[model samples]
Target: MDNEEVKLLLVKYITGEATVQELEQVKQWISAHPENEQYFAQLYETWHNMLYLQPAVVNKDNAFNKLSADIEPKQPSRYARLITWGKAAAAIALLTAVTATLYTRYSKNVESVRQIAANPGAIKKIVLSDGTQVWLNAGSKLNYTADFGKTTRTVYLEGEAFFDIAPGKKTVPFIVNTKNYTIRDIGTKFNLKAYATDPFFETTVVKGEVSVEGNIDNNVHEMSRIYVKPRQVLRIYYHPKKESYSYTAPDTKNLNEIQVSEIDSAKLDRYDGWKENLLVFDGTTLSDIAKVLERRYNVTINMTDAELSSIRYSGSFKNIPSIEKVLAIIKANTAINYSVSGNTVNITRNNNND
Candidate 1:
């Protein structure tokens, strides 16, 4: 979530409307990192103190003068009572804040872990423990242990991301582990994106090289291993029929092997274009194009039906500003109809009867 969403959810938790899932998210956000809990506790205490003073009565005016003239009066801290939960029937805000703290339950031995965020439609950038740079793809996740850079720098990835590794002379091999595979790099820049619904796992090298391997295959021959060269791609697809695996096409059709007089450039930009926020679609089905556009723009690109998915167009928007003009030009020339709604874009067939 963005900062506003996080703040709003915390406020909801504070006021009490957050559901179990939201409460779980809040707990995860808070406990994921030590600094989060510390910073949040300070804010929580300050807000709690302000509201704590609302219900008050004077004990004694001159009583503190017995100890010291400058001594301050002791006010009860509400949060110190972690076990006890009291009603905040005061205001909506107060009730919300209190309910956030009061109703939630947690495991006794829960070692604190705060989530590192990658919002559904947001891009996240991070510096790895090894001084490596990483741009996490949208709708993805990455998690690491607390002492990240202490002994070793390790991370877990859920969706897709690109990494620019810092040279470390193989002191500790930098590793990225996915659901079914793992990629190890001594020092290199590369991209790894395993399509959720698609069958293949793609590792494209932009600058240097990487060694990728399967996780489950015990038989050495059935195991898939590949070393991708600079500007090359290694694709691994698992076949359930043979219960085996192998390396084959780098989307060979996409390889700029033959020059075309009509096109401006005859090459795939690899991860650089995609990482730099460019979406290049060439005769791709609308279904695949929708997925690509959704990833590129972080918007829902929907089609009218399954038949519309087969629509193919060839064009390259090296960057995003060219996208609006490109789409407008396509619709102007073709029988496709399209309209933009906020971030979402809907594509339909232009009636041929007219």
Candidate 2:
């Protein structure tokens, strides 16, 4: 079903107005995919929160009396039951409008967003309304509003994506917002990797120039906007704030650090080879590599050895080979061994390591 139809069904389901068939349909949809379940859970939470904020105040005694009077003579007919359902639906619609109004009044720079997601083990390519092309990697999500190119050209990213922004609109800049940084394109094509689970964030410019700035709310300060040219990569190492004993004055000194380095023009594939269905890992840690492997193969990788997990490896695979072959190659070179149980791979230190 389309998003709107699914949303309507979900609304009815949440309001306890859905028929048995409708409830079963919603259940099937939610169980179809992990994203569907997540979306439904989020919507459910939002509905409850909104209800809490603006309680639907109804005179219980008066409503009960009216309901009794309406059905006092005999059982209500089909038409009467439908009329009651319609009134309840109208009341829900009004409540939704009031919640939206309250949200708009309290929130800043809020807009209805359209989210696009790429599930694990899959890649998706999409063209924006303004001709900008975007390639979303596995386990990634991109969110933007309807007024994309007309009023503002901005999108929020929660994973990795390669953007080839369409030129000619000099007045409106294309902005990509991540959790820790904001990347503003300067008529360029770039690859941005900012997975929330990853310890580092990276942006590699393939052509033209782009500027990167740290998000102030993330406690990253004193760094001005840094411009990255073609074949240049910008990496940010995240340093999470630690809990302190003294609550009076918390230390916010250790913010995320940024580093910029130039890459060989010929080695652009090391950054964006995934677009061509190539898996490239350059000095990537085992733990980080497991994350990528998990997304690529749709499997769970558990690293039992901390020291083994920190071992860095460099390799490349073309045409998306099997997970077993990839792990076999790593085992041959490294001091680690792995066992597969169903969809889970358990990695541990090899006792015969030299």
Candidate 3:
């Protein structure tokens, strides 16, 4: 509607490549601006004789009638007749296609600049430019720009991921972040477990070391200071309204800080094992296992009996964990019966006994 947009629309209109929305915008502009009408009239008159066969060669009256019929404002206009008889039909199709292409291209150009990413599968792996490997857990996304490895290795992550960072020289660093905190990778193979709702941010480092900081006015500690050594799983609680506490700082009051614990490396591997096409589990609650199963298989898992969800599980599965095996195992451990209809799995108690 403005002058610059009007100029651009004119170019698009002439190329027969304006979208339906753009076409409406141009039409409205042309209708509103009397000066635009005058300008087009002058240009039309100048280009009128430049356009087609001379009126003297054909029957002038008939030729005029044909042109008037072709250029009817309510229907296909003179622009449509501009397609020559040699390849008129093909030209019309190509023009319409170009219209859609240009519109889509323009919209995409506007959108791709913002670094939008979506997870298409249950477990997806994204290898970054810096030789770092990211295993996007089910329904997780890692978003960054193409300008990543050159200036900085910064990315925004949603959901969970296991990052095996390539060894960084003493200078360059690898970082992963959620809404609450930042996990600075000290060239470590670590699994970060964080949900958008969970109050605690947990990281288990299997190899090398890692430092985690909470977002307390950018100072980095709320729950505890984690010096994540090999086989050590560091748990840090995040409080939205609390201040950061740094353990390494001099003259700290409480020396008995929350110590990071070293668990079985194999168990940690089982947690991060989604990278190798395996869904490994330790003595996790049946409900927790059900959530993992739902994410991996893309299904809805519901347990009506409260006791059925309380059962703990220890197993590994890949390529769709068999529902029968899992349910049978749960039934043996607890008083539960289950059935699978289509992709839905329903679990109920066999007897309502305490």
lDDT of 1: 0.54
> Who is ahead in lDDT, 1 or 3?
3
Q: Over the stretch 66-130, how does candidate 3's per-residue lDDT look in tens digits?
A: 43433233333333343233134443443344334333333222232223333434577777888
> Candidate 1 residues 213-287, lDDT tens each?
443232332323456677676655544223332223223122222211111223445344565665566677767
TM-score of 3: 0.55
- What is the TM-score ranking, best to worst? 2, 3, 1
The models' CA-based lDDT, in order, is 0.54, 0.68, 0.55
Q: For residue 165, give model 1's deviation from the true position in Å.
A: 0.7
lDDT for predicted candidate 2 compared with the true structure: 0.68
The superposed Cα distance between candidate 2 and the true structure at residue 248, in angstroms, equals 25
Candidate 2 per-residue lDDT over residues 145-179, each given as its tens digit:
65677656777787899999998455467888775
Error of 2 at 165 (Å): 0.8
In each prediction, how many residue pairs overlap at the backbone (N, C-alpha, C within less than 3 A)?
11, 0, 0
